[model samples]
Target: MSMNLIEKDRVATINPLKTCQPLGAMWAVTGISRAVPLVHGSQGCSAFVRYCLSRHFREPSEIAVTSLHEDAAVFGGRKNLVEGIQNVAIRLKPDFIGVITTCSSEIIGDDVIGFIKTAKGELKEKIGEEAVEKIKIIPISTPSFVETHLKGYDNTIKALADYVAEPSQPNEKINIIPGMVNPGDIREIKHMLRLMDIESIVLADISDPFDAPLRPSTTEYKPYYPKGGTTVDEIVDSANSVGTISLTKYAGSGALSLEKKYNVPAELGPIPIGVRNTDQFLRNLKKLTGQDIPDSILDERGLLIDSMADVASRYLFDKTVAIYGDPEITSGIARFVGELGMEPKLVLTGSKSQEFVKDIEKVAKETGAEIDTMIDQDLRSMEVYLKDNPVDLMIGGSDARLMAKENDIPLVRVGYPVYDRVGYHRRPIVGYNGGIQLMDLITNTVLEKYYEPEHWKLQQ
Candidate 1:
């Protein structure tokens, strides 16, 4: 909310908390089986998204684009979008098609929704009524100038739920709206739900898709999309769930939309980063499912506590941390850090969201810790702040890694675009078990710093 804070630097490139919007769209659509995402803009946008996804998921991500050229840009790309959708439908024969507009299309004021309608009409005519009934097309407008990738992802998920969730008789199932999390985290959430004996539906679940097993004896790996993502039928039947659990506040928007349309109730909570947040998520699950917390979860929580206790005297108390990422992620990390008896000195998010300040304030109030919260913050401002007053550690995306290295502060990679490291797609950072993993990572990162060469004496 501090406008002056962002204006401090006009031309400094720092670690960004956010990424491009088209990438977010790609990530979102990856959750759908046989769902081809058609980028309604330049070929570069589609190519860049595919590259990033391939790096993160370690699989070939096939996304179609209108491949806008000079003529399309000047005359408007409506024709390109229409033709692109038709071609993707014919070749891929996907159950659903997601059309996301890029900056180029938005700038030209191309009516994506209208084009989708027209495309649908054309498909109906070509495929006949019966075949048309099998296919669904969803359009989403993602203007990068208006919001970051987080918002774009949120919007895409909301649009999916709106278009796919059907009116059905209620069933004994829970809808799990996991925000933009890695495949590992999604799997962990499903595991926790299974342990609780709660049947749940996770929209766009990509645990298997992004982290499939490697085929031996050959360097060629099969594409992941065909195997991963929630099925279109499952999404349409999500309305049958008893209630919804949203892992992050941003994902709650999609849950809210589902609730409004189908009268399904939703439980909104932060992403389970640290022990306390994970505990909160589990407790909510217990309440919603009318089931008791399993002893296994309790044991996991105990192990996390024991791990922290082993290093509690070392640095748990009076530890200062700086965090930057998506707004919801910043809030979740802030809550988790605060609960660990650490001071979250600086919290920054590139994306602007409603209740961001309120969410941070609530976490600070709950943990009795004061935090400096910033929204719409760029990496330049974050770097400036770090230069002026640094902390013991930083938690964010890959961008923060560089700042941490430069300042000699250890970095905990927590959010999206974790480009430098592998297995980020499968790292679990949610639920009880994930809490244990996170505690170990943080404790080890701190201990690694403690036992550095400078702190040790030369051996005889």
Candidate 2:
């Protein structure tokens, strides 16, 4: 059984793990083809969001801001909103502009939907009705004070479903909602779908846009937006897909919306990070498309199992770890560590989700490992907990780097905002290959710190 700790009363959180909503909204918008995220707030807000994303992905994150000032805050931001849309629509010429609200506009209670309508009409006059109609301006409300970035991503996706998706000609394709995952993870999921020969429309697919290779400017072409994302056409047609699979519970509102509006079957998540979770994903796909699991995938699974067996006793078994990150990702990793015969002593996340506790408890019961779980907590809390009850390793985002260093524990970086390291955005951590990579990383991290020269010699 797991001892789930509720967050104690505090005036404020220290070293809070999650970022704000607009960042998540901006991230989602980047996954749309030729889409630009227009922050409906101050320039500083947009800059922070862009800086955070650019640092993590190691790419130029393009974002626009309304540049709201004192006057706009006191009165209203309708003028700024209309002009921002017009400028972005004309200058950037983006197919979609996600107008994401921040605390400033949200707190003032700006009528964003109405302002968008007004902006559209004004754009019809400036850029012509035909051109204005071509660009879709979706308003996403994301108050930073209310929820974390995960909700921002969820809200943006749901807004897309509400405004864009339509019942159209039927298609055999299924919709995949990959929540807050790296580009490499998205590639892995796509690869698996390709192997299964199942056609899929991955909503907010950021793989190419985020991890795009550097291409020198040529006379023939110069890059603006990188060459990948879910096209607006694909999103509209998503309503007619056979089914929708949301890879994480944190960002499944869009899938749920599609199911409710268009009667599309929806499978909400346990993101496919670990073996059992991946199996569940495959099972869901099979149930939807009647496709059998191919031997190639089975071979990958076999390799993972064989590797686990080989390392279970020597380096992995009975190890203690502290896992923390986004709720769904943390839970999935906790489950995976259990599969690796590692006991997750403490699982913590800054996000407020009761489901996180339930999932951790389920993992504890399944693994027969006594665990301690914390939700809506910060790194400061995790550091305190680790001080009293030390663990062998810590699995989390780059934010935990300091804590791990102080505690002298090996940190296995996973999940979002890993700004301190590069190539993580380019590496898969979801599929069987991801399993092997993570297993190797965890084992090697431990061996590097704890194993002696004699231990290696004996093994040889």
Candidate 3:
């Protein structure tokens, strides 16, 4: 049997592992309060992002676009961008505007920053100095050719940090960068921090806004700007934080850059997915804040350990798994699996970054697990590897789940684009409590397959 089942042609035929860049920028901006994201390119890009987010979050995701036409594409999009910014300003009156560059705009080398500067000038003229001063314009360049959605999210956060944070005297607050997690995960992280008596500012928090309960017909569905996101005031005061903690190393150089620029100390850690990772996260938090772990956290930790002990002998040892997603998420899950005495046989990410590869290597070496790591890898290549060398289970985003299903493999869904399952916007996979939930999901899925009736089993 050959482990090269996926041929070059088949691999070419598979859809890409990563989505378009503008969608990433859109996702980031949606977390902001009363903020409008304007894509500086074609209409389809904006429509696609809105549709995708609406489907996943089960809410209307509002965004604007330049509506690039043949004329704009041929000459320049300056006029369209200026008009689009003005229109959003006049209509939505958002507190801030997040401008994202699309593939077409990047290809044409559109002067997005210049357009924003020009729009700011016009806004000042139209709304007078006082009103214009209150509004903030954040311009993010997301060239699809250069990076994936993961990179886009990191870059946008860095841009936000640069735009709002100023140097200040260090204080007791902590800056928390939770990378691309669900709203529920964000809320849980904040809850855990509060319980530890630690104050933190979580950038782009969207829990309440995105995960609100359904209401009756008479009630109105207001846009989720008034309740979500890190406030502008909070962002301006971030330089005063005593230290910065990033949930995922893949949050990019932005977090570290903020630390250096503001003279704030920094700690890079994995996403708190399972017991081991969550424990490490709590320990780091305690070290940074110089506070003991709270009793509530201890209880949660105890419960997680108890649950793990119950299932460890049967499911934890000598199992093999495959994982693919955003680079940092893949690394975090891979480490968690290894800590449980399982083999992360293959780890893949569509993103091409040195930091991603380095993080994976570091984690794999520490866990003594053999890893086949791939950067900028596509789904086709992953499918090939799966055919060549099968694993006990797979963990990934929606695209990987489809591939897993096609291969008749049981998949534990995590990460972005979890379209097959409901409540993706509220899926919690961080903190001690989150770890237990994730482990339960993984163990139950594995056991369900293992305990299938003999008659129902396939006869090859």
TM-score of 3: 0.90
Model 3 C-alpha lDDT per residue in residues 1-460, reported as the tens digit of each score: 0011112333343567787777777777777777788898888989988887777777777888998988987998999998888888877777778889888888888888899889878977887777767767888889977777777777777887788788766668888887777887898898889899898877666675566555654435344343566676777777788778888787745678788788767777777877777888888888878989978999988888888777756666767888888887788888777766777888888777677677777767777877887777788888878898898889888777767878888999887877778875686878777777778888888777765554234333
Q: List the residue pairs that clash in candidate 1.
A: none
Cα lDDT of model 1 by residue, 382-414, tens digit: 777888877888887776666688889999887
lDDT of predicted model 1: 0.77
User: Which ten-residue region of model 3 has the weakest summed lDDT?
Assistant: 1-10
Kindly provide the TM-score of model 2 when superposed on the true structure, using C-alpha atoms: 0.98
Which candidate should be chosen as best, given lDDT against the real structure? Answer: 2
> Every model's Cα RMSD, please?
3.6, 1.2, 4.1
* Model 3 CA lDDT for position 145: 73
Give per-residue lDDT, candidate 2, residue 273: 83
C-alpha lDDT values of all predictions = 0.77, 0.89, 0.77
